[model samples]
Target: MSGGPAVVTRFAPSPTGRLHLGHALSAVRAHDLARGGGGRFLLRIEDIDGTRSRPEHVETILRDLGWLGLAWDELSFQSERLDLYTAAQGQLADLLYPCFCTRAEIAASLSAPHGPAPVYPGTCRHLSPADRRARMGQPHSWRIDMARAVERAGPLTWHDAYAGEVIADPLAQGDVILARKDAPASYHLAVTVDDAAQGVSDVVRGVDLFDATHVHRLLQALLGLPTPRYHHHPLIVGADGQRLAKRHGAPALAAMREGGADGHALSDALRRNMLPAGFRLGEA
Candidate 1:
């Protein structure tokens, strides 16, 4: 069968600023895949970090996409759904732990020869209520009890459109944050829960998310949700053959919008990398 979307796909972008080229590529590609498969294209604003997200940035993002003639049927924001994120955290709380180590401490531990950066030293994890309460006034966040979550998740598997097959072990990834002590929740918790609630069946994102997908897959398993097919699409790189920065993306997409890129031109720009046969960007 020709390459086509098998289920509902999404492009969840953080509304921190204007959509960049990398963001546009991911969004457009996911949109195309969904459309091609006769599916729906959903947009979710990852506005969990309220400090960075602004109303102006959100407006600009929508305007930019509208300029390109891309439309979505559904939209959501992570900031609005704190209750759902908490429920997901609760599921992990029984098995989850709290992490209070700062960045410098983590850096010092990782600097030691303990394999590829000791995935979370597992410090400050699984603290007693007394221990947890002790830091109530101090700045503290919570982490999932990965050990128990993994056991709860059981064996899991998923197929990737580009990477073929993917399997993960949560223990290796270590315990990631579920809720920041100060913030309502962490991104891992928000995205996992949101995807489940939206009933997203396929995750079409950039290749850089390959590692994060493992963690996401673990969350899906832990939550007892059906795992979605993953497609780690190639990222659009710049002249240096690397993923373009947020600033760089702002200009690229802006220029595209300014050049009267109705529909065809935007499509052409996105398809540039995927069109040519035997054309690999950085592999050479």
Candidate 2:
């Protein structure tokens, strides 16, 4: 059981909307994993996207988690940890470069597809000093120099609870943004940095983020941070056979609580992996 000590885990939810069934499953799973082994569970509010994140949604998140009987040892918000992210960025500055391309410009520059979405063409990676100087006033974000970063990190692997040991392939994502023009840190950077800072030993999240792990593994290697065991659980899906999302109009945990639903009963069912009728775990 490797039960030497309790492994720390976290559930980071962005407060862009109300807590949904999907969020409930994630929080409960993480809390159980921590408490099951005499470890501590932590909560993190990933509200880096100021434009979309709302204070009301955050209040609802705490209320929903409490109703579900999921409690955390400590609570941290990304908004309060700006300096930590900035310090991490400074450490990786050598491996990052300024990206000046706008959304429209990036889209226009892409002809061949790299992945599901358009991969950045690295339009500004090789910019001349004069050209860079000319655009100093333009807002720019920082991107990881994937080539150098992977070279430095070498071949890497991370363990998964179900998938076993897997090799990392961060190149597929190309040069991902480390810092955003609107936010101090991108999700990839912030989550990686925060996990390391918070001493999270295990990462419990949805399989939809399985691919993103490749990039996170690279970041951990580059930043000299310890790699945590990951369990990419299946996502909760709606009756329409689609992953639960706001767009899908999935029922919110708050709505369920208000409608006379029992939080303790829901938590028990979730602990037993018995989702309500009509709802099931989505395929990887």
Candidate 2 Cα errors over 4 Å, as ranges: 1-3, 112-116
* Position 281, candidate 1: lDDT: 41
Tell me each candidate's RMSD, in Å, in order.
3.7, 1.6
User: What is residue 242's positional error in candidate 2, in angstroms?
Assistant: 1.6
Q: How many clashes would you count in candidate 2?
A: 0
Number of backbone-clashing residue pairs for each candidate, in the order shown: 4, 0
lDDT of 1 by residue, 126-236 (tens): 467899778767776787777777777787667888767777756777777778855688777787788889878888887877777778888887777777788887766
Q: Which 10-residue window of candidate 1 scores lowest in summed lDDT?
A: 275-284
TM-score of each: 0.86, 0.95
Candidate 1 Cα deviation (angstroms), residue 98: 2.1
Where does candidate 1 clash, by residue pair? 21-249, 96-145, 97-145, 141-181
**Which model scores highest in TM-score?**
2
